[model samples]
Target chain A: MERILRIFFNNGSFFTFVGLQLLCLYLIINYNSNQAAIAAETWSIRSGKFKSALTTVNGYLDLREQNEIHRREIARLRSLLPESGYNITTEIDSIQDDSLLQRFNFLTTRIVNRSPYNPNNTLVIDRGARFSVQPGQGVMNESGLIGIVDRTTDRHARVLSILHQSTRISAGLANRGYGTLRWNGLDPRRMTLIDLPDYVPVAEGDTVYTTGFSNIFPTGQVIGTVEKTERQPGAGSLNLTVLLSNDPLRATHGYVVQDLFKEELGSLNEN
Target chain B: MRGNDAISNALRFLLILFLQVFLFRQVSLGLGGKEYLFIYLVPVFTALLPLRTPRPLVVLFSFLLGISVDLFYETLGVHAAAATFVGYARQFALGLLEPRDGYKAKSSPEGKDLGNRWWMQYLLLMVGGYCVFFFSMEAFSPVYWRDIVVKSLFTIPVSWLFCIILVTFLRPRI
Candidate 1:
């Protein structure tokens, strides 16, 4: 502090010297437009950077609110689907209502725990009876389908991850052919699709989707992409190694998808 | 700082102030165009301040003198600020040309008592400083730096000539 004083007033009466200079500066700033503009610009740049820094520092504090907003957005989009009218060949009357539907609803949850090394890798999700979550509902995130709910407690549910060896989900291709998607239990990133004929026009890079044949997941939902194909010469069947869209082992958030028409669909299938 | 010096210096101050504002300040040099020039003489009063006057007192007196002139010229504070600058610089100005006797035996600075050479040097420093500062502040912008220089150069000699004529003729009883 004493050094600072010395710098301002090296002479005996530096107080008067400094005070007059400060008064001149104040007057200049008030009366000078060009100088005032420069000053204002400097302040704006400095303050803007400071405000952004402060926001980044507090970003972690708003994570829960941000997550809640994203969850609500996904739920809203879930109940609405594209209309068939977008197709030129389909009749306008055949188009279903594209407005919000009660047929599909979602409740978002977090993955509390999960395992990949086990033969039946199951996920413990952070929603159960308290969130109206039930067994057999398909679970997914924005990237694509992950699993089906297997059991529930008051506040949590256990899901059978698609990585399980016993899992067999009917899959669809862009050409409308059928295949079975199953995890081989060795490489966690690879899922095997089988029972489609080689004449099905299958390609290595073609996308595979859920067929909605079992009424578990919505029709046209993404399953994975074809990675490689194997031909059984005698059986005339093609086996495909599919690459899952997003690694479920690394996923943190989830949504339980409920199908409102599941009972009707099940009864129809039984008949 | 003394009785005699105060009386004599006050008389010189009033005399120079009157002649400057009433007579010299009104003179105009023009070329019949939109251009003209001002003749400055009030600085002579500041230039003739007693050599041994205390630095602080000199600054204060010069400030008061400049401000009083500003009242009539209506360019308030410009004159005062310029005068104060000259007042503060007087010590250093004299330092550039110190005497063997070291500023002793001098009641007032004049061409008669001090040699014409010493007096002219002193006059140049005081008037030159006052004019540069006054015109720079009057212009109020650095873009007119050349303008300030030209005005100071023209003002210095004319003001300097008028001061000699006053000190020699009017002889304010110092």
Candidate 2:
């Protein structure tokens, strides 16, 4: 022990030098932009690998609840079948509408990780780049919007939860003008809708839906219902409190929405 | 004499911090829309410490100075990483550049105590190394090797000139 102590003191500078360099490496990876990107990519892939085993265990624990959700979803999808609709114009020959184009495609995947408490929380889904899951695509379930895809690896993708502070969904009253929907980073069950004109009628229990202006989601998708409304004196707009329909913490499955015409629409905005 | 040396070193640290944060930081030299040069004088603080200063103290001081400048740069750890490397390597560099008669027992590495030629060579090695390491950390990958090389090449001579000017203006007596 004495000899070891002597050696340590003798080369203290060497040890400190190595130690400090390591600290600097850590800081560089965490804070610097280029290094941070590389670090984020590595961390997502590694964490996904480690979390998969735990996710398997959790999946078994939630099997019963998941089956119930699956049943509801199947029934809902079945209701959209043409056979379920009655043709009132049986006398006239049926003609398919050529003017309408299918623009949105949905890919289903399981949510493998949940982080609802963070100021900017994120979720990890089992689908990734190989599954055509790109960043900026929206993720939703039967309830409402879960989040937008933030980053992706080969087999998994990280989603920016609606509970995150940066989340701003373009939403509006089901019958009135639109506004921006935002999370206040304080409540998981509620969000704030701003920029809606005070002239527009807003009241408790009014449903809010995505305006489809951004092309990330289809028009008329349910976001939530207004729980509270406040208009400051002399303010031109009303601030609304919305109770979210989707609880991201309870979500196990999500459909990643890909807008087929997104690039075609986005290119015009760039010009 | 030792007390005076300590006070002067402290004052030098403050001066460099001021110049770095307020003055040099605002001056940007870019070419073709890419920022190719930055005036970095903070590394000189560690490079010119007294010849006999402990290596650990040198490394710690470099880390502090780099982090202080980083606060202004809003690039938290980039400068700190480069400065720490320079500080740790300073001893090896000094050993390489030692004169036939050797350094004075109680003198800082300044142009007056050391010959201008010797000081210039030392400044070139230290500041040049700083610029290369800094840009490398900023780029953070060999994929940006061209950018790193371009930035370091444009920045080295200018940074070296600033270090020389600083050493001359603040001629530490100790």
Candidate 2 lDDT over residue span B8-39, tens digit each = 77877888999999999998889778898888
Query: Which ten contiguous residues of candidate 1 chain B have the minimum total lDDT?
Result: B30-39
Here, model 2's chain A TM-score works out at 0.70
Residue B79 of candidate 2: its Cα lDDT?
A: 91
Candidate 2, residue A115: lDDT: 78
Q: What is the Å distance of residue A91 in model 1 from its true position?
A: 39
Local accuracy of candidate 2 as per-residue lDDT tens digits, A5-50: 9988877667777787788888778677778997788789889988
| lDDT of each residue in B1-174, candidate 1, tens digit only | 331377777976787678767986778675545223666666666666777676666666767777677777766566777777776777787788787776656555645555878867777787888889877766666776887887777778877776666656644456
Recovered share of real interface contacts in candidate 1: 0.00
- Give the poorly placed runs of model 1, Cα more than 4 Å off: A1-271, B1-4, B31-36, B110-113, B170-172
- TM-score for all predictions? 0.45, 0.48
Clashing pairs in 1: none
Best by DockQ: 2
Candidate 2 residue pairs in clash (backbone atoms < 3 Å): none
lDDT, model 1? 0.74
